[model samples]
Target: MAASGRRTGRPTLEEVAARAGVGRGTVSRVINGSPRVSEQARTAVQRAVAELGYVPNRAARALAGSRTDAVALVIPETEARLFTEPYFLDIVRGVSGELAEADKQLLLTLIRDDKERQRFEQYLAAQRVDGVLLVSVHRDDPLPDRVRMLGLPAVLNGRRSEAEPVAFVDSDNVGAGRSAVAHLAGRGRRRIATVTGP
Candidate 1:
């Protein structure tokens, strides 16, 4: 057989297969974590892969109908608040933890102004990210409606209203509000007030 030339000093799939003493298809199955591969073959392929430092080409994977394996954590707030606020930091940590387990990349984008918000919407509409995780969305924001209309996979940290159409994950704000009022009333306070945000 003819010797394959090294291209750019990166190990290729064919080379891994040769080193593992298996066919290219077997190597592919092992790399892709297919259950059909046998234990012995899988071990050999893994050893060869590690020895050669083989890294799969993500661009090629995308061309083969695979997702970009990336998600966007969209925070509709200023950069200063995103860093200063403990709430945003907790959300970031949670999202990062889940994405790390799934081996997907996270793209954090902050929308401080209308221009940047519009640009992000256009980017999402282009399907650049596999999904979106929107945080700190208010009642008046049109982003949830746009995401639903575009048929992109999205999850919100909060809902706009009780009848919100999109999927969201939020705490029981109403329950907390009621509990606060009850506590105040129990403390013999005749005057109680609540503040809300847009």
Candidate 2:
């Protein structure tokens, strides 16, 4: 519908599916990042999205319980040193690889304060992400606990606890940390400072 209350023939979900030569459900599955979709179907749907300039209606989708089709790898770290950490880069690479296979995009958020976390809650409450992957949280951090209370599926990058509900992927941090110091010792460095945190 146009501002003049006339139909402008704007594309609809059905049209998009038809243009992609796939069923409506298939189109939706692709749009929602369902792993069952084939790459060929995914490509066709993406082509239709580009050709028709289709923009999903968030309000309507909310009623249907459709996800916003997004995810975030939020880090509670300072922006200055965000990119300087090699571990973050490796983890990002691993995450990017998995997310790319699903054709899902990752949004990054820096939650470093009460004010920022407040704003983060507002944005997250919009249901923009299907889930969240948080990194660099402290032992006593309240963010992960808060995220769980919101009924959102969240995973921590580092292992916090076995009893903790947050799902995570972590390396042998303790063992790796020890190996790093030993390697430095063999390199003839007598003094070192572990500055992994702010």
For all predicted structures, in order, the TM-scores are 0.79, 0.60
Clashing pairs in 2: none
Best by lDDT: 1
Candidate 1 lDDT tens digits, 83-115: 998999998999999998998889999888789
Residue 95 error, candidate 1, Å: 1.5
lDDT of each: 0.87, 0.82
**Candidate 2 lDDT by residue in tens digits, 141-162:** 7778778887789998875676
Clashes of 1: 0
Candidate 1 regions with alpha-carbon error over 4 angstroms? 1-8, 174-198
Best by TM-score: 1
In model 2, the number of clashes is 0
